[model samples]
Target: MEASENWLVESLRLYQDFHAFDLSGATRVLEWIGDKGVFVAGYESLKKNEILHLILPLRLSVKENQGLIPDRDFKVCHGGFSDKPVFDLKHVPETRLLVTSGLPCCSLKVWQITEDSDVIKAVSTLAVPEEGNLWPRLAVFSSMAPGVLHGARLSTLRITDLESQKTAYTSGIGDSEVLSSLQVLGTDTFAFCCTSGRLGLVDIRQKWTPSENISPSPGSGGGRWCADIRNGGQGLGPSIASFCSNGQLCLLDPRDLCHPVSSVQCPVSMPSPDPELLRVTWAPVLDNCLAISGFDGTVQVYDVTCWSGVGSQVEPLFTHRGHIFLDANELDTTPLVTTHIWHPCKPRTLLSAANDASLHVWDWVDLHASS
Candidate 1:
């Protein structure tokens, strides 16, 4: 394996006096759309609603002699309702649509970013029939169909059309398996991970039949927190990269959902041993590379091009420890890496959010050289 110590890391400030538990009570709420990043945080005081949506332009420029700084050319803040933690944010650049979901609420709000006004305006809001504390863990926008949004609410999955402000389809994943994450596979197909440690694929065109499920080995611990479909140049039909509760990273082909094409263990062990709160995503530009983050407060990147079978073992190409606390005495209080997002256009650029309410941008220098 080739290793390089050439990585540039930058710390970004989101909100003043921000606390992680105040707004969302969780982190994985960062999304990158075009040149802008949308983050959800909570206000410090109780006078206003807790949830605050921050829109930050992510472009960077080098000053004549001031090195590099984010081109703070534009910034916008939108207020949300109280006690509604924004659990997920997704942006569809093609449609200029922004979708957000809050926990304990069944409502999904669709907004449009107006270029002329440099503001986000709500286009429509659709609420699911059910009401619960953990409904709608995440929302995913489909590129195959403009204005079509998919969401997972506890054991149920819902699909809505933003143009009509109506739900197109809804189905329950029986046996009480709560959904943890969602991914769009194709125009009519999508994949979801559940608390039962099973990965399922559903085709919306097929009336949401009994999903084809993949169960991990016995005693491997079931429950997949996050799954992302690979967008490589390879001709594979919608391969999946999933992070499971057993501390396993799995790569599977949705066409053949019975078995995983590759399965490897995560290097950074979770500090709390709770595996149902992690995230995994494929590299936007790399064919077989991906990243995983969890309660470990570290991010790991692995190249699975050589993965062949169940026992296949692949070491991470890079391990990012920038989120770890530098003070030895504060090791016990180290913040977890809530989520990490790859640049939509840049091959080697990645952004990660931590429980400390800070965002870090990591640029892999070696990967850029080879690309």
Candidate 2:
């Protein structure tokens, strides 16, 4: 592991005063996209300043010397009704299109960044379910060359044209349930993890089907906590790393769906005994090593040779003092660690967000002293 010598800090200033309900510190980072070497992030802030407010997209630039800079000078893309917006933004890597979800009145909006105009021009807009809180899910399929681009709501997943708001393909997941996460498994396939503890495979080329499934415990805990599905593992198809309730980690191949190659129960003697709220991810560049973090401050790195292989657990490379420390009853109000986003431009570098409304950048560097 390597360490970072320099650190930069930038604050976008959520709002002068709280704007939302009692959600003074609830912020969810939806997407982080980098083009060439420049990076942009989009997230939703529930409390703007100090007032109860609607959600809106917060944008920032990642640069070496500039630290974190707000995209204030960039052209603003508008949609929906809420003056405040809750958004899901994704970059079409092929076309370089910026797609956004959740505006006061708008559901999905596509925009083109014009270099000459230094502005973001609205490309197209699509209508979506306006009844429930509509959060957009984004995924890309590369099977058909550049792959099919799609989005999923709580009940439906549909493909949309970048230049036209027309629906290319649409499938239903029903209205009574919620989708926890969505990942593009292949050129024509996608994996959906639902709040119902249901994991289903959707084929964009065919009618979406339950090609594979994993049921969690009944009630609210059955849904997946987090997922890492990409084609880097030793397997030929998509490999899944999902955190299930009760401290169980299940790794499966969505291509086979019939069974998981391996499963591991989180070791009990963790730094913190609280139920594990695990966040699992595989490095985009590294296939052998995977990173896992839990509700406690421990971060584990694993050499995934095989699912059931012995002597696989590598030592925990590092421990983080999670942003906040609190008692059991204070969990709800605790300054929870929300996410860890690896730097797209810098390998071995990571960014973390916490309930304290702060973002910290970490680099994997050796702390061993000289002899």
Candidate 3:
């Protein structure tokens, strides 16, 4: 592995209050435990027969930058044979953590975190019988019922009752295409992006089923390799933000799925630009703002509030290249930033992990800050 430049590290010390940690593994899912200063992440362990999760937190230091300390470690298994990275985790409101993973040996596990300490107690566990083998590509908790977990199980959407171990409902997410990402819109509604270049809105209430799905903008050449999907937060109600496979960021209003509010050419990752390497997420504290990663070993934050419908390129408000340092030639070496997320309670604070097993918890000090 290559090292960052001394000059760049020196510059990062100027206004970047950041800390890095070695997770010893790579994870696809990262979720904050509500407003707490802690978060949970999980990934497959090739050496072990199962997956391991870490409840890690950043320790605020007065004398130095914050550092991530491992709080707890837990294991969830019977999913070692999954073909794709299907391990996903989400925090439910009732002190419960919902998790799903597995293919040939499918299983779902729920754990309860006590209010006293980080000790996670196993509340429930269920194994999806081999007869149905409904592998989950994406999973999220149902806002209406804490016991229900909804997942995009390949060809169909499965809303399973974790308490009773029964399939509550099933519907088509897309004609069997892989689901890239899923975001909960409301109690019984969700927005998702499929590998087939389709962004869809599905609601369980009102017996909702759409006859058609929406495609990307016309200028996108009719092919969308959607990498990620997220709901626009704060004041943008019913607003959806999706990073297309074509490297174009799209603003969408779920009320009219067929038409996009705007489409702009977002920056592509350096060295290699692939949809699978890129991810998008909106901030809980900022409006018309979102973060994009897997772009040349850095996370770029942009404010779309100023996006003009002319299809022009929008510049990022902040460019975070802390993951990789420029060589003497000033080019990035480790160019893939695996995943990034915004702090639920802290404004402008970001947590990101890279392919090199480096986890970062950093806050950019805006000289001219905004609310």
Candidate 4:
């Protein structure tokens, strides 16, 4: 069993490496644009600037075994000092737009690639609150209105219209909990997870009112750190994948959020060690599979096809350990996984970034074949 696990981990081919900046902090955001490009966001504490990199994989022939290389002239953007900046990209068939917040002397900026030029250009800047943390926990483009963007402020969720450069709607989730993440469900509805271990469903068409609230446990404080809505498939309606600070992954049905359809505990050491979940994203091709990054420097893929109810533990399909541990204790780690993202078009490709200023592009086709 141990030998097979080692082989599976070793079969991950290092396709590319992206280390252009002198960034020391862990990457806070990573997004892939189809199979050709990726966007990485990180903060440099010494320089007090946020770094955004747009990397394109070099086109090579099949006979070339030198590995995938980044373009010689990759694009880089620098923002202001922020612990976590809200960064996301919107890709359509014809247009590609990138939205980011928490820049120095700038609240929100929208960038897009022009048809004539490959360079990214600023298109608009949205309004933001004057006080509180400038970093937004969530920033997502609305599915219904392509020009509209929804982002979370300190305690409120604001929707901005990119075309008009105006605030469309703003609502607060009260003072009890902080908004952790947001996932758009459909045209008019979206779901948000909170630090209070609560899940909320909001309908923008209904005057931005929260229609439902589901509290999984009283005082769980393991707040659902991240939530992602799956792309429907396999006779299943839209469901949610949520990861809590206490290392709990729960699958909840949108219709009945009061109880989770399935729940699983993440692998962690004993003595009540709090494992921080950095990111959670569903596989672009596989409907029943999802990947999660942990603060302990591990990335795990879980298959939820058999997940049916609470108290049922779901084992990870595969575990990838790219970051290294410096000391004997797990608490003292060399580098941690800050962000990880699966390829938008390729099911076997994944990209991960760590605080050690390293980026790895992993191809897991061989591992899947072996399994």
Q: Which candidate has the highest lDDT of all? A: 1
Ranking by lDDT: 1, 3, 4, 2
Residue-by-residue lDDT tens digits, candidate 1, 232-343: 3124643687666556767777667667776776655643354544778888777677888875777787777777666545677766666663222244577677778776
Q: lDDT by residue for model 3 over 1-371, one digit each (tens)?
A: 33455646665643455666665455655666554434434454443322333433434323344454553222221122223343465666564554545443355666565555545555665555342433455456554555444444345556676667677656743455556666666666666676555777666664546422545456666444443334432234436676665567777665665666777887665323545556778787776678887555788888888775747888788877766753222334563577788877677778887766567677786654643
Give candidate 3 regions above 4 Å deviation. 1-3, 6-10, 13-16, 37-45, 49-86, 102-105, 111-135, 142-144, 147-154, 172-174, 219-238, 270-274, 326-335, 367-371
Stronger candidate by TM-score (3 vs 4): 3
Residue 304 in candidate 2, Cα distance off native in Å: 3.4
In model 1, pairs of residues that clash are: 136-153, 197-222, 197-223
How well does each candidate superpose onto the true structure, as a TM-score?
A: 0.76, 0.64, 0.76, 0.75
| Local distance difference test values of all predictions, in order | 0.59, 0.48, 0.58, 0.58
lDDT of 4: 0.58
Model 2 lDDT, full chain set: 0.48
Q: RMSD to native for every prediction? A: 6.5, 9.2, 5.7, 5.5
lDDT of 3: 0.58
As for model 4, its CA RMSD to the true structure in angstroms is 5.5
Please count the clashing residue pairs in each candidate, in the order shown.
Answer: 3, 28, 1, 1
- Please write out the lDDT profile of model 4 over residues 1-371, one tens digit for every residue: 47546644554453232222334455656765655655655554434334444654453212344655555444453233334344443443234666765533236667776556455566667666553543444445545456444444425576776667767766754543556676656666667776555777777776645644546553245444667777652125437777766667777777766777777777743212233335778887865788887545567787787777565555677766644421122344455666788877666567776667566565544345455
Model 2: per-residue Cα lDDT over 249-292, one tens digit each? 66676566546556666552333233223466776665544566
